[model samples]
Target: MLSGFFRLEYQNRTVLGEWKKVHWLKWKVSIGLSTIN
Candidate 1:
């Protein structure tokens, strides 16, 4: 039971990490475009 809980937590963290990475990339791209224009 404890192992399953830990596995779930790990999965959540990875999903969150990927989400943050995608958002960060999009944010940077928008900033770059604004600066260019």
Candidate 2:
């Protein structure tokens, strides 16, 4: 039971990391576009 809980937490952390990366990329793209315009 403890192992299962740990695994679930790990999965959530990885997913959150990916989500942050996506948002970071989108932010950079928007900044670039704004500078160009």
Candidate 3:
């Protein structure tokens, strides 16, 4: 039972990490475009 809980927590962390990375990349791209214009 403890192992299952740990696995769920790890999965959530990875999912959140990926979500943040995607948002960060999008923000960088938007900034670059604004600067270019």
- For TM-score, the strongest prediction is 1
lDDT of 1 at 19: 100
**Residue 23 of model 1: what lDDT?**
100
Model 3 steric clash pairs: none
Candidate 3 or 1, higher TM-score: 1
Residue-wise lDDT of candidate 2 within 1-37, one digit each (tens)?
Answer: 9999999999999999999999999999999999999
Evaluate model 2: give its lDDT.
1.00
By summed lDDT, which 10 consecutive residues of candidate 2 come out lowest? 1-10
Worst 10 residues of 1 by lDDT: 1-10
Per-candidate clashes come to 0, 0, 0
Root-mean-square deviation of each candidate, in angstroms?
0.2, 0.3, 0.4
Expressed as tens digits, the lDDT of each residue in 1-37 for candidate 1 is: 9999999999999999999999999999999999999
Error of 3 at 7 (Å): 0.2
Each model's TM-score? 0.98, 0.97, 0.96
TM-score comparison, 1 vs 2, better candidate: 1
| Residue-level lDDT for 34 in candidate 2 | 100
lDDT of 3 by residue, 1-37 (tens): 9999999999999999999999999999999999999
